[model samples]
Target: MTSWVKFTVSIPDTHQDALVAQLSTAGFGGFVQEDDYIDCYVEKKKWTSGVQTRSREVLQRFAKEYPKLELRTETTDVEDRNWNAEWERSAGIVDATKKIVIKPSWKSLRRRDKGKIVLHIDPKMSFGTGHHETTRVCLRLMEYYVRRGDHVADFGTGTGVLAIAAAKLGASRVIAVDTDSWSFENASENVLRNKAGDRITVHKGSIVALGKRPFDLVVANIDLPTITKFLGRLLTLTRKGGVLILSGLLMTDLVPVLRLINRRSIIPLLLADEGEWIGFALQRT
Candidate 1:
């Protein structure tokens, strides 16, 4: 259980993407609940007076530019840093038709179904230790696209979970890429744990640095704007007739993202949901 500082802001819906991106880059995680408002969660050490000062400076800048926005700050008690809480809280068991099992590094494999494929992940803060709705959706989608001997790419590869899933699901080659150094480092350890070094190559960079390798499958479990920004490039990275799995979207947020994709004429073959989150599987024509 780790402590967190919650900063709330009310801004125009149009500015939400930029604000979230800014906050994320500033080391705060954004949780948006509305078009005009979002909550930013920052760790205690990162929430010093300097952070508050910077927040005010940023708010002032935004207000000067976008006068209708509002800024608010509040402090709340948070559980100690357990890092593995999600796994413990969720019990770390994911069930699906393909009999795939995602286990946390701390727990032993239990109650597994026959013929199940298991992938173990160490609990970490970056993402995709398999506890979030977005990761769940991506994992299921990966089961569909990844076939034996197919090359795969897990863009925004947090904790390397999706990349590991692709490898376990029978993809012969996997290229996992992430802009976050922590995530990339975590992915390296996971690649070794899965004994997939021969099949999975984890790299630190965005799709841009991964170059133009066309893959049989590409999975991106990042937010809507990032997805939209890279959708065309993602399609280009995916071979014709390959599959692309995308998640990390709210149900209400999917329309704009879909509209953007449709603008490029990339029709999705599947749309899925787990809880309030939504995901799509697109086939590159």
Candidate 2:
């Protein structure tokens, strides 16, 4: 039998969702946030307990780092396994950058002059729904960077949205990549849905799995620290003087991340920001 633990935290209402998202990425499931309080359940293994401790530590760290924010933590049961099933009933539409509409399988695409692009996305258990800040920033960057008939490479392609968007923008060929099997499967399905199955090729593996072929443009919406760590490899993947659109960063994280890339001779040509998210357009020098 698997054991589990629950944490109930008193987080500010405004910051509850972000806190939940961070915890979700940390592997603690069962999120409930209401009236300045957040709750979560964690699997009760040694590693999970360590994560719980570390999560509390991070809450304390964040409190010290951002003094205005407040969060409280308590531990709770994995009573209902069927909780995730409720998600299917709540499947709905998501709007992306520039009013782009992403509809779930339950919804139908309607033609409208709302100046919004429509995408058919039945993500199932996959991540990239274009609802996250990082994905949204990347979409905006893709719109700005992709050129008609350009060859594009989308690293960490969550739902193949970036690659499909590139194809929609007239990229002759698109290579979509992700390490997770679930994402790879969903991306392949999503590409077919958008009638981009022919133009975009879905590859399952890390950025390394993408062979030595250089691309006219490479866009990675992974977080700042990851970007910094992989900057060299990313540079090697781009053609001489190709554009790199990097997002999934907070304003505070952008500078140091950019500095690391700058050392590698990558230069930022544009900086775009929305909400607390920031993205950059960099060109190889």
Candidate 3:
């Protein structure tokens, strides 16, 4: 039987998101943060020696970035089981948009959800549920930008929620891309769960691999660094006058990201702010 490794990461400082981003990049998912520690889960097979080395390297680098940051990780072996079902029991339905709802696979909708579009998401080993501010903001942005017959690209499509939402919202073709193996697999399954497999194709790499296809809309709900890294190319991938949505940024990221967008001659048409996270919508025309 396959097992799971739970890393109870303890941090001495409040710069937890930095570690969360690093862990996500390191292919760890299903993060549960608490007052003093964060729990990160990974499949036993993928918890290779190389992954451990890379994780240490990230911590060493993070020490330099945040002088007060001190990280301690303790690993626990977990038996393979239906973790998603456990999560579903506690996962409440969220009205991601007025017309769009996000619910777990086993949950039944109430009368209030009538006429709403429900996305049956199962994040077995990925980091996207509609509960986070970033995810909700990105979904809201899609509500405004995703048009009927639009070709959309969702970069870092964890659990494929945004791509599925785009497909449900009327995008003719939706391409969901993720670099993490778990995310790719989880998103692919969610795509099938939502019955959006016909319209959404899950790609297992960066957006660059998809070539120069003109997408009517491109959404990237990843961290600030990742967003900045691909902002230029993402802009180019969208057709002229098409929409681009960027999220997963802390409030501190506003200035630099806005400056980067300004340099590219792209003007943000809308700003979606939820808590400390903010998302922007830009039209390439």
Which prediction has the highest TM-score against the true structure?
Answer: 3
Off by over 4 Å in 2: 1-10, 20-61, 74-85, 89-91, 110-116
> lDDT per residue, candidate 3, 1-285, as tens digits?
878889888974366654675677766757766777888887888899987887777788777766765677799999877776667665778888788888886778989999998999877767678877788888888888888999999898988999899999999898888888788999998998988888999989988755699799989888777877887799889889999899887677799888888888686899999776799999897
What's the true lDDT of residue 55 in model 3? 79
lDDT of 2 by residue, 161-192 (tens): 78888888779999989876667988999999
Per-residue CA lDDT of model 1 for 1-285, tens digit only, reads 557776778666666644553455455532433657766667777787877776776567556656666666555646455545533554466553356677766667675455688777774546665556677778777777688899998898878988888888888989999887768888899889889999989889989766787999889888776887888899899899999888887676777976877776566888989766788998888
| Candidates by lDDT, descending order | 3, 1, 2
Write down the lDDT that model 1 would get: 0.74
User: What TM-score would every model get versus the actual structure?
Assistant: 0.74, 0.80, 0.86
- What lDDT does the true structure give each of the candidates? 0.74, 0.73, 0.82
Q: After superposition, how far is residue 86 of candidate 2 from its true place, in Å?
A: 3.5
TM-score head-to-head 1 vs 2, winner = 2
Error of 2 at 63 (Å): 3.3
Q: Total clashing residue pairs per candidate?
A: 7, 2, 0
